[model samples]
Target: MPIIDNPIVLSDASLVLIEQKKATANFSHANWGDEDLQPVRREIREHYRNVQRLVCVYCLGSVSAHSAAGAPVEHIVPKSQHLHFMFEPENLCVICPDCNEFKSNRESLVNPVLTANRVNYPRNSALYRIVHPHFDSYDNHIAKFNRLYVECSDKGGYTIYICNLNRFFRRFGRCDELVNDVALAEQAERFFEDGIAPEQP
Candidate 1:
């Protein structure tokens, strides 16, 4: 899938709350889950769950439709390190619990120099080493064969590695039932035969 075409638009009340939180004397990532922000967080999760079609951005697995715990809001640039971007719409998306756990607090930027001291979030896809759910197309960076994932670019490799996309394979071992799809295998073969080169990091 490509970048989220429509990011969540916060209501005025939500924005006010965010602004109030930002203005606090000792604001930190811990404030993210404050009681006042619970509604906003739920809205974010619901919006992204629909927008992402109930699919995890990292591994394309099914996300829960009935529970917020099934799909949690993800900060493309971790909020722990960059609290200023905690509510940036472009930095938000929904990911499955596995991707959320494996990718916890890991740096996603391609170059820290570009983000240091910056007031605004980076808009350019090149600034991110991982496949950006907001700026990059998932298929352009990674190709999938059933449960197996193949990297088509540096961003793909970084995303797969960070999220451990192959965890299922590692746990169950490669079985014909998982990788024996003739159509998918042929499509993957054609993807390589087309001479597509990985994007340079």
Candidate 2:
């Protein structure tokens, strides 16, 4: 994982839809999974996927939007606890399904507070116990070795524990995936030269 610059700008239509949903749902959990919110979810997922180069934020695993079991928009702050950040762009990022499911609704920070009086979104990295995709760079806190996810800082360790990133690699062979990626890349090079496409795995 590396430092990712995510520029999540919502369209005017998206803003209007969000306001309508907020009014109807009264900022409840219902608003988070509303049918009208699918567009927003898609937008967030696509944006982060691009920014993260289609890799999982926690494990650096490959992800595909086309795959049925692909990346999901992860809430940095659990929406169940902090409903106010349900639609906050800075609170969202795309991570592989393994990380998403393992991290579901788990509090990853110490003294996690949502303040309305703040002038802008919280920018203090020290406030968060986990590695923040927006506030902290991944490489600065964690280092990866083949399939192993190792933490170099407290935040990195907290993130690994919350997401069960090491367990995910143990369960799913990341080395095998890397081999597959390399083979696919080689096949692509051959296809460009010989005009022959490889069969889908």
lDDT of 1 by residue, 45-164 (tens): 989888888888899897899887788889989999887789999999999999999999999987776686789999999999899988888888887767778898999999999999
Global lDDT of model 2: 0.73
Candidate 2's displacement at residue 120, Å, is: 4.3
What clash count does candidate 1 reach?
Answer: 0
Candidate 2, residues 1-201, lDDT tens digits: the string is 234676588888889888888788357865676787888877777788888878787777877867535978888878787777777888888888888898889885566654543445566778788888888877677655445566768988888888887894667655554456776557556755765534421
Candidate 1 Cα errors over 4 Å, as ranges: 195-201
Model 2 TM-score relative to the real fold: 0.77
- Kindly give the stretch of ten consecutive residues in candidate 1 with the minimal lDDT sum: 192-201
lDDT score, residue 24, model 1?
Answer: 90
Best by TM-score: 1
